[model samples]
Target: MTLKQALNRTREIFVANNIADARLESELLLRHTLNISQTQLYIDINQELSPEQEKAFWHLVKRRLNGEPTVYITGHREFYGLDFYVDPNVLIPRPESELLVEKALKLAQHQPGVTIAEIGTGCGAIAISLALNLPQAKIYATDISAPALKVARANCQKHGVLNRVRLLLGDMLDSLPQPVDLIVANLPYVKESELLAQFPVSSEPRLALNGGPDGLERIRQLCRQLNGKLRPEGYLLLEIGQGQETAVTTFLSNLLPSAEIEVTPDLSGIDRVVSLHLT
Candidate 1:
């Protein structure tokens, strides 16, 4: 089968199953299967696929039809224009989390020696992205799951930030050796009650998505720990779920009554990122 034929077939199958972004996912899976770049894929769009290649491509499509995420099949995800190694071990990095990186970059600007901590670093996409952008900054990437840290460590090395982004094994702020000038987290904000019902996300490690009854459990605990782990006047940027703005902001406000709290929306205008500037 030609590359174009394979791509079309995959897209058709994905669309029939009601998968969102069917065309994009089809191209991504095809590129991954052939280990080719998008540019090359298009350049050879009419090239015939070897029997083995065609079989391998169909196998991945089958996995996707069975509810496995395409990123897991590809074992790669892109965040903030950087490629990350991902698997079932860590939550796949989401584009919405890029807001956290952007805000942190601006906050850490001109402060070459600034210290930053990323709670629940998952695949280390956020920490490594910041480290690469702010080479002089001290960055700590922490996760409670040992296996998740392994994935983060690999990405740190892949991005050549091994010497810069420290991978620590601990929960939230507990692993930070010292208070940081900036704390950014995309902690699991999915309500525990809703976790099991969320597909694709349900395939991710429960440790990375469970946030107790209200989906603010982890966010709340991180807020409570800001006293010692966050320096005076430091900034905290958190990615939250829809309808969580009031609860998360109220919690942060009551905890640090004098701090400045702000919520930023994603492209969809959802209240996705909550920012707090400590006084």
Candidate 2:
């Protein structure tokens, strides 16, 4: 079949299979299969798809049909305009996460040579992006899973900010050598009951998504420990799951009553991030 015809059929299959963003997903799969850019696709729309290419495309289609995340299939994802390596070992980076980075940037502004810590540094997307954007800042990133840390480290190198990021393998900041000027995290916040209904939890790592019964277990623990780890008057920024802002804010308030805690919305207008000052 011609390349255009093959892509048409793949798009139909993806849409019929209930794949979200069907056209974009099909184009990505085809681009991976053909080792070409999306722009190139239109230029070569009439090119014939060899039997081997067709077979490989079908394999990827099957995986997507089974609800696997496309980033895992592509083995990479772009964050803050930089590509990062990703695997099942790490949670896929989301658009909502950019809010956390923005908050961190604003908080760190004018604080040259500032130090920051990022808990659950999945794929090192947040830490690397922060390091890239705030060149004068030094970032410490931690993850409980070693495999996830491995992916995060590789991503730091890919972004050429490894020199600015120190990677730690431990739960939260348990293994850090010292406290930082700012602490940022996008840790697991989905309650077990909620996760039971949504997400391929069984497919992804449990440690990355399960935040106990109330979905604020990790956030609570982190908040309690943050006072000791954040410098006096330091800042804390977090990316929360949907419907989690109020709970997270309360948790922060109880931990530091004098601290200023605020919930910020993402570009989509969802309460997606929380910021706290260690007053």
Candidate 3:
């Protein structure tokens, strides 16, 4: 079959399986299988797929039909405009989390040699992006899962930020050195009961998704640990789940009573990130 025929077939299968963005997903799979650029794919649309290429394409299609994420199938995902390796060991990087990176960069812009700590830095997406953007800043990233830290460390090295991003394997803030100028986290905020219902992807790490009953447990724990870990006048940027602003705000306020707190929404206008300035 030709490239055009294969893409058409793949899209039909994806659509029939109720997959949203079927066409885009099919195109991405085809591109990955063929090891071709988008331009090359378009230019070579009529090129016939060798038997080997067809076999590989169908393999990926089956995985997608089975609900495996495309990023995992592709082994890489783009975050903050940088491509990073991904696998079932870590949660796939979502675009919404980029808001945390944006807020952190803004806070670090004027502060030279700022020290930043990232809690649960899966795949090192946020920390590596910050390291690339804020060249003068020192970054420390921690993940409780050793496998997740391995992926993060690999990504840090891939992005050439390994020297700047210190990877640690421990619970949030527990492994980080004290007195960091800024702390950013995108911890698991999905409530335990909501996990299967909200995110049915079995391939994603449960340790990166379950946040207890109200979905604020991990955030609360991090707040409790922030008192001395964050330097005075430092900032804490957290990416939270929808409808979590009130509870997170209350918790952080109670923990750091004099801290300045604000909520920043994602592109969809959902309350997504909570930014706090320590007193």
Per-residue alpha-carbon lDDT of candidate 2 for residues 23-131, written as tens digits (9 for 90 to 100): 8888888898898988999999998889999999989988988878787898878887888888999888887898888889988978998999999998899999999
Model 2 steric clash total:
0
Candidate 1 deviant stretches above 4 angstroms:
none
- Per residue, candidate 3 scores C-alpha lDDT tens digits across 188-252 of 99999999999875789999999999888898888888767999888999999999999889888
| TM-scores of all candidate predictions against the true structure | 0.97, 0.96, 0.98
Arranged by TM-score with the best first, the candidates are 3, 1, 2
Local distance difference test values of all predictions, in order? 0.92, 0.86, 0.92
Residue 112 in candidate 2, Cα distance off native in Å = 1.1
- Model 1 lDDT, full chain set: 0.92
Cα deviation at 208, candidate 3, in Å, is 0.4
